[model samples]
Target: MRHITSALLLSGSLLSGSALAECQNTGNFQQWLNSFKHQATASGIPANLVNNALHNIQYDPSVIELDRSQNTVSQTFLQYAANKANSYRLTNGQRKMREDRPLFQRIERQFGVPAPVLTAYWALESDFGNVTGNVQTLRALATLAYDCRRGSFFHNELMHALRLIQRGDIKVPEMMGAWAGELGQLQFIPSSYNKHAVDYDGDGRRDLIHSRADALASAASLLRQYGWQSRQPWLVEVKVPVQMNWALARLGKKLPVAQWAKQGVTDVSGRPLRTSGNAALLLPMGRNGPAFLAYPNFDVMLRWNKSTVYSTSAAYLASRYAGAGQVRYGNAPIQVLSVAQVKQLQSKLRARGLRVTKIDGIIGEETRRAVRLVQQQMRLPADGYPDLTFFQKL
Candidate 1:
């Protein structure tokens, strides 16, 4: 298993300057990059390859901007859904699916990755290749690697990116992508490209850049590697009980389908819960919004992206395009709190020894479990919602 974590850059922003001073983009950026490049060459990378890559390298400010922006995105599922499933996007998605039928079909046959999943990822990541970002891969990866927080990881990623250029799979200038260095039709990071990409077109290259065959196949390979069950659906929209505890829904609490049926959870059409696998109760919106009983495949998407809303969107969109029925969200407004405040409350809870697992401000499984534990310890009812009352007490 490729034990993935956030790029080391995030660790730098954690403690302020930390160890980044060593690789910070001071005036010595070029010098350090040259030395870094030499070490890369000494480690079996070609010197000409390093010179060819470093010669055109320029610092990318946008990567830093996007790196910062990831933490501040809104929590509303609709906001995310509207952005992901917009009209222009849907139109373009259909067009791409039709135009690239043979390539997509070939990829699906080989990788067992459904076309809709590939289509969804394609449309979402780079807008079906229309809006692939134009950032230098070397600089983006190198700058991130040297950023002290996640330098080691990014440095390794930078090496893989340079290797792509060396292997002649993609031109250095054409290796553009998201600010984080994810490339081609599906937004795969450099490390992912090295690990999962395939030469589906048989052109003697794992050409994700200009070939839909390779890109879609590569995406499918990634999902399969991540344990996608081709025979299974991604997630099923479910009927949640009225007066159900919203806090409990977000905890990734798993119960048998029969147990859920006994408690009023049902299929989207109000049928009995299908007892095939243990389902996790998920509520992206608040108490009044739509709820889903997500299955194992849902966790697969989380492995790709840690965000709940992102994986939810991928599952929902994939199912939607795959002929799944639309779902109706009810009237619950998930509590709106800024990112910073969430962190503040979490830090306070940590100080009180409540075990708010990760320090990130988001109230994920760990934080909610910590909340429930604190509530029980305080001789209070253990609802896992973080409220102003909890903040004030902290």
Candidate 2:
């Protein structure tokens, strides 16, 4: 939550023999188990698995704090990358790239998920092995499973954690991670590990904590499983022509790359559009700010987390490692406006009876087209640029 993608949230202290003994008091744990057994078993999670997990689980407060705190702290994409690209992160990324070249190469060879991308995750998620926290896995899962906001997801994942413990893959103490119940390096969720973790190190245990091979492989495997197209660019900064079509340059609606090219959109340097895949356009800061052309891989990252900022940040971070310079957008047709002005413009259109969705500050494609229609109706230029005058009319 602290700009960290995965949060492991195992107990800070490894359970001592005494604490283990306390939790293993069969009756107390059974009471906790009963609350979930009925629902989990009815959902087709085997009863044995449910008991196997619940019998060992406990509550972790750190995870709850992390979940709650995450919403309060938001960092812009540049700031996130810059903060993570500190000397520590870069040094670790470099060390991992060299020390684990074979492992990184394997991830690339197997999944076409490049090494830098995996390494970026390595540095970002866990500081390349320097700081995998010591949270108790079962405890973290149990806490999240009990939390109402994400009980169903955590409950299902908790069953998998129990399955791992029951199978003797990872014990309670070593199952450490960030604050959010993500496990090991490359910060996998329990279900993510259960499905794709590999014994790349072949050290008898697929230990994501210590093994670079296992972590990178698991990370790539997760991406591939989520439909990452091999060798496709995930994101590209583009130049919007002076009279860019406000409606088409929107993420809310699908537009063929060719159609966007037809509308005079080009790569940041004004090169002809080279991509063939269907893509969507997004302006997180409205029309006056940076614009992006997001491809299939962008959607794949969205599967990890849906916020436009997060996905774009990942794409940009990975691009930095890939030797691309920080992208600069063409001069914006309209000056950047604040959320208030943007919303006011939208409200005006709605007042004029446009089928606008809401007074949400974000002017998505529908809102853009709707604004353009209103502009044309007023005999204005109809370019769809938001300004104080646009709001004054309504």
Candidate 2: tens digits of C-alpha lDDT, residues 285-337: 44555677878787777666544555566676677667666656436544555
Give stretches of model 2 more than 4 Å off.
1-30, 33-62, 72-95, 252-256, 329-394
93-115 per-residue lDDT for model 1 (tens digits): 67777788888777777767777
Cα TM-score of candidate 1: 0.83
Worst 10 residues of 1 by lDDT: 1-10
Clashing pairs in 1: 8-149, 8-150, 9-150, 12-149, 288-332
TM-score for each predicted model, relative to the true structure:
0.83, 0.72
Worst 10-residue lDDT window, candidate 2: 9-18
Please estimate how well model 1 matches the true structure, expressed as its whole-model Cα lDDT. Answer: 0.69
TM-score of 2: 0.72
Candidate 1 segments exceeding 4 Å error: 1-27, 56-72, 98-102, 243-252, 331-335, 338-344, 357-361, 374-394
